[model samples]
Target chain A: MMSWLGETWAILSKEWRCELRSRYALSTVLLFAITTLIAVSISVGPAGATPEQRPLMPVLLWLILLFAATAGLPRTFVHEEETHTADPLRLAARPSCLFCGKTLYNLTLLLVLEAVVTPLFLVLLQVEVADLWSFAIALLVGGVGLAVGSTLIAAMVAQARARGPLFAVLAFPILLPLLKLVIDASFVAVAGEAQSPALGLAVLYDSMVTVASLMLFPVVWNP
Target chain B: MTIKQKTFRWLLFVWLAATIWAAFFYAPLSQGFAGKMGDAPQSSRIVFFHVPLAVASFFAFLVAAAWSGVYLWKRRSIDDHRAVAAIEVGMLYCVLATVTGAVWSKVQWGAYWNWDPRQSSIVLALLYYGAYLSLRGAVEDSEVRARLSAVYAVLGFVVAPFLFFILPRMASFSLHPTPGSAEMDREIGLVVVAAIAGFTALFCWIASLRRRVLDLNAEAG
Candidate 1:
């Protein structure tokens, strides 16, 4: 387990270094996220938006995450393909190990996106942030759900036709439950309503998806 | 005729007769969760059909997943056929379940759509599996289609527990009754069990039919 964690960390750091050096995925994601946040804030209006309108925040946040993750997924494998290194890597390492590595990297990328956007969202949308700690916790739980689901789906849809939109088509319905929970958690967190219960529920969603992906990744990743 | 086909047919006929009898005769006609709880303003006798269809959807997906595992493991043409056949039948059952659930919602909730967790999840399940079938239909290459569809089937099965089970438990506004609470009475439980059995037998019969159809297609190819 320790070795697996070490390998996963290695993959995560490698992906970070690669993204930082090239700025391909990170730059696109940051640009897209910031643009979308600005657009949503304008649409909601700086002065007009209120707590009743806050449900829209979670929805818009996930929409951004969905698009950003979809855009980032192809990069995850495309970089490997362009370098022509995946074959040697897969031949040398366990596929489960590879999946673990990829999942960590994907999670890191998603977390980075969330970290940048959450504060921007709070400032732009005037979110109350019932408890700063709980809000952060909710974001962490919700982000992990999106990360793992996106990783598995990205792998599945990578080789298929129309990988771009097909990822959304395939991933959206499967993601509704998690999205719903995240929205609910954020709504409660921002409104200062049912904070504990809502966060707990979000945790439930995260655990369910995490356990499922852990069990099933090896099946799809391995030959 | 193959031994499997002959035995399956005989069993099918027997279960068909049994379901007809139990659904029409043995199942009780409750006025609503017995007396006070039966608030639907009408008889709750639709339980037989609704419960059966719901259970059949579960059984159908189980078959789909099992066959998918076989296809992925063996990479055989016949297993691919089985996997596709099960999914088609599962989609059929899922549709029936959704329709019946809609009707029940209309009667019980005073509207056809309540945005209840179970209702929403069932609709999502139907759409998801429908997309699965659509994916299959879009691809022309038999081998690529088979392999990709198998992967999607496995993913659907993995993500489904979260969609159907965990999410519902977390939500607050759902009007649908939660399973396995003290609210359940013995009569409802017994009828639900009988419905499950009846529907499962029906599911097995239809799956057998679909499998035979697939076998025929394979042979002709």
Candidate 2:
């Protein structure tokens, strides 16, 4: 157990070092999110939207995050495959550990993104999150859900042709339910509607995806 | 085909044809299947075909997921063939259901697309298996494809319940009519039940035939 944690940590730190050196994924995702935020704020200027359309603001924020994640997160595995490092990494670490570490990296990356973008989204759009608790939970849990689904898909996508588009194609449908739940959660946050089971469902979505991915990642990551 | 197999095929053909005829001629077009909501009563005949196709498609995907689980456990190429065949048939049925529902929607709800919860749910389900097919297409090696696709199939099965059930129901109201509402005609109900059974059998027979063809290809190549 200790060895498993150590192995996972090693793989995670290896990912961090690689990211720190290149800033490839971080920069790509951040730039995508920032650029989309800019376009959204420019066209749909702060306080420009009517009250009828205001309820959709948080949903738009999530859409930006979803597209940004899909654009960049699959590189976690695709990069390893591209550089021919996957085989050695497979040999060195257990499949579950590799999965855990990669998912950890993705979760952190998404958190970093949300931290940067959410405040900007709110400020630029002048969107009032009436229920900050639900909004925050939705971001955190929905981000975790994205990380888990994206990592498994990244692993699968790495083995396939046209890795870039296939990652989003495969990941999007699986993430749809989570996206629905998150949208519901954020809708409440935007509309000041009464709380719903959206957060609980999002958690359920995360756990189911996480457990299934953990069980199956070994098989997917292997021959 | 064996004699019994031929006999069953003829029976299914007759049964389904009768179902279609009855759907239009025998089943009464009630006042409103959607009760007060005013979904076109004549359009409600779509339930006879649409419900069956939707149910069968959902069932076919589950069967594929089961076969995928079998392949993962046993690592048989035959199981993979079965999974792929089931998905292909499932996709066919899913598309049929979508078209039928869309046409019915246009007649009943004044749009080919209503963005109804049920419609989105079915579309999401279609994409789930669509991704499975694309995954199979992208991989060159048979064994690796089977293994990786099987993992995804199982993952999808786990998520299927929430996708099919909870998320769709989260909306306060869906424009799609509920099946067992009290105002629906009993005659319509009977035909729907019969059609559902008939279509499910048809789906299974077609999927098995496709599976046999796959098995033959495996042998030939």
Instruction: For each candidate, report its DockQ versus the true two-chain complex.
Output: 0.34, 0.81
Q: Write the residue-wise lDDT of candidate 1 on B15-123 in tens digits.
A: 6676557656665555444443545343466777777787778777777877887887888878887777777877888888888778877766567877788887888
lDDT for residue A158 in candidate 1, whole number 0-100: 52
Tally clashes: model 1.
1
lDDT of 2 by residue, B34-137 (tens): 54465546777888888899999999989999999999989999999999999999999999999999998887768899788898988988888788999998
Q: For candidate 2, what is the interface RMSD?
A: 0.8
Instruction: Give the per-residue lDDT of model 2 (tens digit) for A1-223.
Output: 9999999999899999999999999999999999999998889855666688787887789999999999889999999999999999889899989999999999999999999999998888877778888789889999999999999999999999988888878988899899888988888877778868988989999998999999889889988
lDDT of 1 by residue, A7-49 (tens): 7777778877877899898888878888988988898886735
Query: Which residue ranges in model 1 land beyond 4 Å of their true spot?
Result: A1-22, A78-88, A193-215, B2-11, B21-28, B33-43, B70-77, B134-148, B180-192, B215-221
Query: Which candidate's DockQ is highest?
Result: 2
Looking at model 1, the pairs that clash are: B32-B38
List the candidates' TM-scores in order. 0.83, 0.95
